[model samples]
Target: MNSRTKSINELILTAKRDGRSVKYVSDGYHTFDELYYHRMILFSVICHANKDRAWKSWLHDDGTIFNDTFIVGIQTDEGQYTYHYKTEYWDMFQVQEVPRAPKYDGHKPKDITRLLTL
Candidate 1:
């Protein structure tokens, strides 16, 4: 496994436990802190491309897995809005609460499609 990927994963675990957020906005991946910002973007793209639009992370070596996903973007005929994507791919992801079916009350014919948790 790539050490960079491993370090990034560890940082995410720590952040979730502390209930705090990180902000590392450099392209350099030499340090654990530097991986925060880039990890968010990379994971979003990966999740968005996946068939199920979710990422499975084995947080510990014990083999337990957690599903992670997020809303990456929204689009309508008016414009497109890309999410800032602040969460990590493997952090406390995927809401545990049961989801309710959506209600599209007054959307026009050119309504936006679903903004999936990718």
Candidate 2:
């Protein structure tokens, strides 16, 4: 609906298409609608991952929905991304972009920045 939600939806969709599980945990929600929306998103992702795709059976089951201060790391071909969403009233969230680091073979040295400094 909103820009933030649209971005989140895009991220979730990308993750789903790539056959990756999205880690979504919220500290708290201001309104019931917010909570419900989050839950539905989570459910959709989980269902997409499931083979049967029948997650409604467990909807009424006992379980904890949200956790406080849970950190999630997402790994993609581009790089690793760490997402954190703290307790905010409005539709606000933080996405920390981390560029992919160069790989090292260990035999030959790569990224001579440290060597250059010395």
Candidate 3:
């Protein structure tokens, strides 16, 4: 198995032993309802390499596939956003710094919205 896979496996073992909940968010504004212990393990492996960001594995609820890697980016009012899957894959387990989305008129959209919404 490749190093990525191996590291994921090891992470899985550790998470299972620790019993921590694993959370994953996608760019499309979707979040995992609840992640399995093993899945959290895989996430930990990815996080280890990408400390500045969060990582996730896209797997069927039944745990059939776990090859896809998702990296966390900026969080918004909607929810946490992730980098494109292709980008994450091409980086070879490297975490890409999520560019701070351009600010609008010296304030972020969320900041503006927060003021208005509240």
Q: TM-scores, in order shown?
A: 0.25, 0.23, 0.21
Model 2, stretches more than 4 Å misplaced?
23-118
What lDDT tens digits, residue by residue, belong to model 1 across residues 1-118? 7999898778777987898665542346454466645555554555455424342322312432234433333233443332223335434334222132122234443433433322
Query: Candidates sorted by TM-score, descending order?
Result: 1, 2, 3
Model 2 lDDT tens row, 3-118: 98898778778988998765543335344446655754553343244323121211111332134422223332333222223334112222232232122223222432222221
Candidate 1 displacement at residue 41 in angstroms: 14
Off by over 4 Å in 1: 25-118
Which tens-of-lDDT digit does each residue in 44-74 have in candidate 3? 4544544554433333224333355433333
Displacement of residue 79 (Cα, Å) in model 2 is: 47
For every model shown, the clashing-pair count is 0, 0, 2
Q: lDDT (CA) for every model shown?
A: 0.41, 0.36, 0.41
Provide the global lDDT of candidate 1 against the true structure: 0.41
Q: Which portions of model 3 show Cα errors greater than 4 Å?
A: 25-118
Per-residue lDDT value at 39 in model 2: 51
